[model samples]
Target: MSTTTPDRSYEALSYEWGQPPNGDFQIHLNNGHSVDITENLAAALRDLRHQDPSLAPRPLWADGICINQKDMEERQDQVAMMSDIYRQATRVITYMGTESDNSTGAIAAMELYCEWWNNNGASSRVEMGSFTHEETIAIQKLLSRGWKLLLMCGRRTLAHWSLLSDFVVHIFDGDLKEGGFLLLPQSSHGTDTRAECIYQLALLRHKVQGRTISEECKLSWLLCDFQVFAATQISDKVYSLMSVATDVNIPIDYARSARSVYLDAAKKILANADDFTILHHSFPSQGQYLPSWVPDWSKWHYGTEFVVRCGHLCPSGSTRPSVRVGELENKIDLKGLLVGTVTFLGTPINDHYQRSSNAGERAQWVQQELESIKAHLNGTDPSLLMAECLVGADVFLDVRQRSTIGEGFVAHMKQPEAIIDDVERSLVNSFVTAVRRRSRYSRLAVISGDYVANVPRGTMKGDWVGMMNGGKHLYVLRKTSTEGEFTYVGISYVSGLMQGEILASDSPSEGRWLTLV
Candidate 1:
């Protein structure tokens, strides 16, 4: 083994370890020791070796090859140092496996787009229709590449793919003349602008570049964003992010169980976060081992579209969290007031409805769901309430848009035929986007006091809805067998209680401690 100085120049590799190839892909060291590596790593090594003729024998740092994965202590130490390793490297070479899925075309298309963008003064006037058919096809391929890479690595590592990252952010940040244009292929439901994912990437880049974000907020956001990424070992979900997240300090010990690592990470985040934003990421875990309060990063959850705090909806309202660690493992006590119990659950807005090509069918499904929720409220017209709940209380849209959309929703409910007009069409599009943002992996619920909520799918009729002190979103808690104890169902978006209405009447002192397991 050789030791290198801090000033030494080396290239750090960021890649997905795809499935192993058919043959045993092995490399021999100078000491004559053969080490097996994944097919993706082997491809990356070959690409790095021949990228430049004169840069032969370039010093490289690849996690699979350099880190002693078999040794728990060494793995932990190496992982802790990964952040500095990537930051100090001459450049980060991100290899997204061998170029399949028309990746070459995607790269070419990106170059073309960048060239066009630079020539056009980065104007919002440049629409997707301006591109030729061939160019559009290439752009679609490029977007597919972006989504694949994003799902594989998450946003933090996307910055390494400089060209694609910059291009996507530029498009996302551009102020279009009208509504934004679609960059990806047109969905059967018409051209739905898949800008949400791009917007997230752009937002992350902006925050990181601004350097004004707190370490706590940064770590919390990073953890939320990283939940979608896949990893061979579930613990790596937390450990892999150790390099990018400056605030989190959980030990990267593979010797620990996945649940243990997840629990420790959750505890650390909750303790340090400025608000209860981390709780928004928690969902019902399929496994019994993980506590309901802790997030299971291994399993994918869909309601994250509404997780971002917008500084408006403060259910807990200026109260700091009163959290105490329980004497028993996998248990915590939090002080908060119960908003109400869920009295009715509307049909879940499944993925099919969200991805449906028939706009009429999708709209009808949403309308029926809303009508069902309204029926439960004793024929009380919940037009605005339903609108607010569906779109997450205007968190994503501006005040004017929210008003217009809310009015459109009322009109749509009154006369479904009028939606064919241009204005109404635009309204339907906005409504669809809003529903997609909040409703995926969730269902509409009617709580006590006739309040409506956008709750996680698993929320039952009897689940208790409460707001943790300093939390932006209300949480759904299920009663446990033990008295005065509950298990977390998930976060919820309640219409009336979202704006601190409960806090206005009930003081923080009135809140009681509820144990969560």
Candidate 2:
């Protein structure tokens, strides 16, 4: 092995769990500890306990405890015990309770699970990817220390079996757990899609973030743009989805034709069989179609708007579904507002408000700021778009109480002042930097869905299925001029293949087997 662990490993590891030298089966660990899993886990333990009544304690390495999320760190530390845990048992009781869950409630992995697990009794060394870039460097450094690569998530599925017309590795991830119990072989019910979705997502992220290959940088975005436009015209293309469970706007019989044509046109423009993203850009009205509401520039706006409205930023300052920063930062100057009248409770009195007339007028200032940029290294700076509205399921909430001023008393807007920053300044360094600063959309603000596509649904306030990583569901795919291949980011799922391809958990009477949001 090189002094540093290889950035990646290509070693071949085969499983031969039935080795009989010492006992029923054997497992070798990356840490150099050797243990036995035996032929059957439960039976073997029973036999041992039967032989010596005191010898029957269940092993932690048993599938029962191995996949618990609470024990994640210990889980990582004990990875070396896997082969041993599986090999030595004389009667490994196979649990097949919930096909989609992790180990806790899992009896058997989904059939779509990787083949590396196909062999019942085998042991071998296999190559795997580094945990991360830092891990890659660490592994390289530990190469001389004899650290071995015993596991990898994607190699056995995507990299190993690309020939299949379709393959979806499901139900191996340890989380996304639902409630369950533990019995024979230890099992719980969870989402099988978690593992593969996460696996493929992580891989997609890794590839896009890796250093760019200069030779393939020549494909001008114009070609990619046209291709994307053409893709939307194909058979089926996904629209941004609302994950709410009730009364979602499924197409009616009469509307289906128009919706299909509209959606098909979108599909043709994006049917390249690769990951693609829509622009989340917000711009002031330059075309005939004006957005429902435009931001007001009368006063500086804070990011708290999104924090409460979209839950884009949490109270602890960690970003998950949350996007904009400064939503809560207070700027108490008691500034300007749009004029609106509201009556107070039982007061029989009405008062005028000072907020902006429209919800989106705020973007005007950001656009002006972008136009003023001198193209210094990065093209544009970004700002937070804020709004607070009360929406209800199946209907818009009455703004009666919310909009009312206290007993005919006008409350001037004392909201926080907006602080300007480069796109790089957002909490997640991974986002905004490239999408907002490096690409074609550098000069735009985060626009609403209605503004982006000129669709009428903008007024509809459906629950959004946002990301936890501060990443927007917008992924942009750009082809390298050299290799003619594409590089993308910010998209929902990266591939045409998704968890729904393998198994669907929903009842067929409800809707489509798989939904793309």
Candidate 3:
């Protein structure tokens, strides 16, 4: 509420308010009166107030203090200005409050680790054997912290930083002598607010480290990361994110419904990005009224492993874009080419179950899923089928060799059974990169007379798999009761569809263009 000066600087605080546990504290105002503020903010203010005796009282902007929550208009205005407020501020302090028993040790370990990295250079894998027992324990505790776990979430590889927390949690439960790791329950402290802190802090850190972030990409990150950020009001998720979004420029409207705000944000993002990649990021929303394509940012959605976008079918500058979408009436108008119909399907490959840790069990489950798919395929040649299913099979194979699955290929095949097991493993391993992507909840759909692809859990046996004009990946389309109408069932990783199979086939009658809404 004060004017800025060149000599003066403000620091923004990003942390959880945590129920105002210490209750209220009095703050003296200019009118010689006092107002009550939460204990959390009071603590933060006290911390800042006592900070440097040499300097004047530093200006700080904490959301709980600066914005009047009772005033909706003021909240909206303040929320809209958040990006500017943070970006313009000299520093953004993330206050996790007083360190816990493990936290102090974790912080020390992090400082030492960073120092080591600075001197020794960066290595993707940490050589834990080189560290002292105390160092190992400290590192483990740090990795399991909410903020650290948030940073590791949705990562491409769960082998390093992501798995460190699990190792720490289950160190005594498993036989680490044989390189076996056990699953551990996720921390209760992994709140949406913690995720929000990680994302915002990491983003700013990226800039500090001299990484170039384009304007368009920030919106994508904001959209993806916003899903885990805590917000009291459903609409605030969108409103809070608007400031950070570069591509999506949605107006702050307190009158608008959360759905409307979300839909508007999606529209803006699509309009600016001109790709269906945004649409592919969708997961089922908790609110039934929310659009299936528009993600509900307030809730957690599993199986968000990054999709491998092979540049074959929808390669850059391919004359025809892979996806095209427009709004018609009250629904989104989508037009895409139907690659093929799913004549056969595999059982949902559940890799995330509690008992899925056993390698033999994992192999057996995969084998069963593959057998079902192959049985449905009948006598169809696997190569021809794969040719039809993938975009760049050769390229994908090359990429797989370098992936975590590929790195452990020999170990995975140690006790393999029938030929179908290897085939299924290879097929599943090719497109499915991470443990998260290989969900037991998601099934594999075999496009009739074309190729096999992976679809979300709810995909039916007869669901249609198509390629939106500018879409990066194949999409599952379910036919509605009404003729010619189809609903999008989320994006599918159809293996063979990407390598120009449509062009290779002489029979044009095999494929048809359908309008999706």
Candidate 4:
């Protein structure tokens, strides 16, 4: 059914009313599509009303007014149901208000009102600041639920621009669709600031234009600094926002003042993005020498994996800032690294039945090879060779276990009737974990190559990566799990190190050392 309000006509089929505040209010459309809406918000619908145009119109659910927060039972019931509120609203209308319902003060005004769920329970609510895993999960959950925000442009909305990616659906100029961030003081009463406002306005302009930005919230600086810190995404409306700012119907001249500042920011980001700045250096011996660096850049089995920070300076005075980092494949041919390959091995492990060798033969052969490799490592006089070789081992592991490069959100939903799925995953993770723990032992059989990709959760950042070499060592570099870490186990030849594999299978191949008769 198509529901029309006084201002807009929206088509709706069937949507559920969740428990209240933070429950899941899912909408199942007539066409068999759906999305989630939140059940709680910072503001009520006192002035935010809509008319139903359809013959059979569905009711609008608003938490502040609809649930009667004054009623203890109702407030308790509805307040904790934020998941359902945003899930239920076909489209969210963010009435540009001064502050959030729960928090007091100016900065609190910019909060997306809800009963925030803190993973560590450090606090029930948190203002968006740096990149956090919980924040990433929260935003990703919002995206999965399909909530289009209708941001109302008022004079005091001093929140930063980074939050705009998830908060602002479509901005209203209070007249047109060109509305942007409200300007504030260098130090506004609430958590408000002009730097955040300027930064966000610049970001929305770029994103809507289909351009990508690596970072957000830049402080005003020299032209050269601006050139080196440009954002990645571009907005279609940058030109339009600039052109229409001075129109009497919708005056935004102050925004015009920010143009030179933003352009300079954009230029700077683009320049830096083009050139990779070295954060920490490897001993040169530790890095893998790809084809380009080949013959000239010496090669072994593996090279040092480089680490770089992806960020731009927060335009001066901006209290909040963010950047997204991801691993990009380098364009290079083969080097010290061998391309390890995998397919669903028919015999995942050498069976107790049809053995690749005699019943006890598999165990005996693998143990002997482990001793040989251990001896080689012990003989090495320098740490450089060990580091390089260890790095090489990591390269082998990464290339071999390419299938385990999990896309996180893939397994989020519940499989209602499926009983063994989680158990299976647990078993797999445990096995993988075991291989990782025992990797450091020189005497251990290295069946699979292993490495840990530490993504500083919430930010798709290349911020800190702790790579373990020599078949699955966690290394001393990393400390916490909150940093969004995933351990890897690369399936390799078991004869040399079956300790690395809980499972393995192979066809007789001539090279890389096994001489099978």
**Per-model TM against the reference:** 0.84, 0.17, 0.74, 0.20
Best-to-worst lDDT order: 1, 3, 4, 2
For residues 357-471, what per-residue lDDT tens digits would candidate 1 score against the true structure?
4555656766777688878899998778877887786687777787686765654443344436777766766776667766766888899989988888899888999888878
Q: How far off is residue 462 in model 1, in Å? A: 1.8
Span of ten consecutive residues with least summed lDDT in model 4: 508-517
- For TM-score, the strongest prediction is 1
Candidate 4 on 375-401: residue-level lDDT in tens?
A: 544542322221222122333234433
* Order of the predicted models by TM-score, top scorer first: 1, 3, 4, 2
Please give the range of 10 consecutive residues that has the lowest summed lDDT in model 1.
151-160
RMSD to truth, every model: 4.6, 25.6, 7.1, 23.6
Full-model lDDT, candidate 3:
0.54
Score candidate 1 by lDDT: 0.70
lDDT of 3 by residue, 1-517 (tens): 4525667678877655666434358678788976567765666566557445998767788888777777889988888888788888986765544444454555445445444644665333344454556655654444445442222121111223323333332232222322222112234322122222333445444453463465344565566654545666878777777766665677888888887877777656655565666566666434626555666666655424233334454521232442235655224555456666778776655442233345567556655655666776785545334322322234334454434333333344344344445565654444443333333246666777746676777788788877655566677888888776777777776664564554454333233445554
Q: What lDDT is reached at residue 471 by model 2?
A: 28
Model 2 clashes, total count: 84
Model 1, residue 109: distance off in Å is 2.6
Candidate 3 weakest lDDT stretch, 10 residues:
148-157
